[model samples]
Target: MIRVLVVEFTRPDAAAVALGRFLRDEGVEVVHAGPVDTAEQILRTAEQEDPDAVVVLGAEPPSLPGFRVFTTAAEAAEWASGGRSHTADAPSDRAR
Candidate 1:
């Protein structure tokens, strides 16, 4: 299952909330409502949840130590899913 860390500014937009719900409903292990304000928490949550990647919505980009930014949640989620798409892909470990 692809775990996701969804960050939002003033709560999530409709699509963002729906995205989290859909991911969980689809049996994806999502870190639901993982909204955070600080860049540090975002990084820490990523470390703790060890999500495949993050899906940000309605929030400014944060300067994290080592992370990529995507325009949309779908795009990010797709990028995160790429690792699971191929049989030859290596498993990823959550880093702290």
Candidate 2:
């Protein structure tokens, strides 16, 4: 099963909760990393969890390699499920 790590900078809002449920419904293992303050903190969580992908919400998009930033929970869910086509703005190995 696909595993995804969801990271946020602040308390999870309705959208974040909804995304967790959506990912669960799609058969993806959702792991919540809770609130983190910096990009390094997020990277640490990712390393610990080692999820297939990382979904960042609210926080500024970090420079971590292979991380995806989404403005909305729906968009993140779609990307996680392979429903969204890759684009220049999509997740890449390049760091920002």
Candidate 3:
């Protein structure tokens, strides 16, 4: 099962919520966070979730651990399009 974290603004909620539900139904652990107002908050949340992938459904980009961040749904789609490649990093504000 893939664990996913989401950092979303208003621009990305619809898709984020929908995907979170869909993934959860599929037996994937989806950690959907936000109405995230800041990158720091996202990093903090991701640390706790420790997800395999961090999905940023927002107008801008988010930063995660060993994970990739996306600005829009289409970008996320592309990042996720490659299947295994989607399982990249998690969110983290820490440098170490």
C-alpha RMSD values across all candidates: 3.9, 5.9, 5.4
lDDT of 2 at 69: 50
Per-residue accuracy of model 3 over 1-96 as CA lDDT, tens digit each: 556676785454778777766666656667778687777788888778766667777566654556556655555444444444433363233212
TM-score list, all predictions: 0.66, 0.73, 0.66
lDDT for model 1, please: 0.61
Considering TM-score, where higher is better, how would the candidates rank from best to worst?
2, 1, 3
| Candidate of highest TM-score | 2
TM value for model 2 = 0.73
lDDT tens digits by residue: candidate 2, 1-96: 566788876555556678888999888778887777888888888878766677778846677785555656777777767744343364433322
Instruction: State each model's CA lDDT, in order.
Output: 0.61, 0.71, 0.64
Estimate, for each residue in 41-87, the C-alpha lDDT of model 1 and write its tens digit: 77777677766656667767676555444547678556655545221
RMSD of 1: 3.9
Which prediction has the highest lDDT against the true structure? 2
Lowest lDDT 10-residue stretch of candidate 3: 87-96
Off by over 4 Å in 1: 10-12, 65-69, 77-88, 94-96
Shift of residue 61 alpha carbon in model 1, Å: 1.5
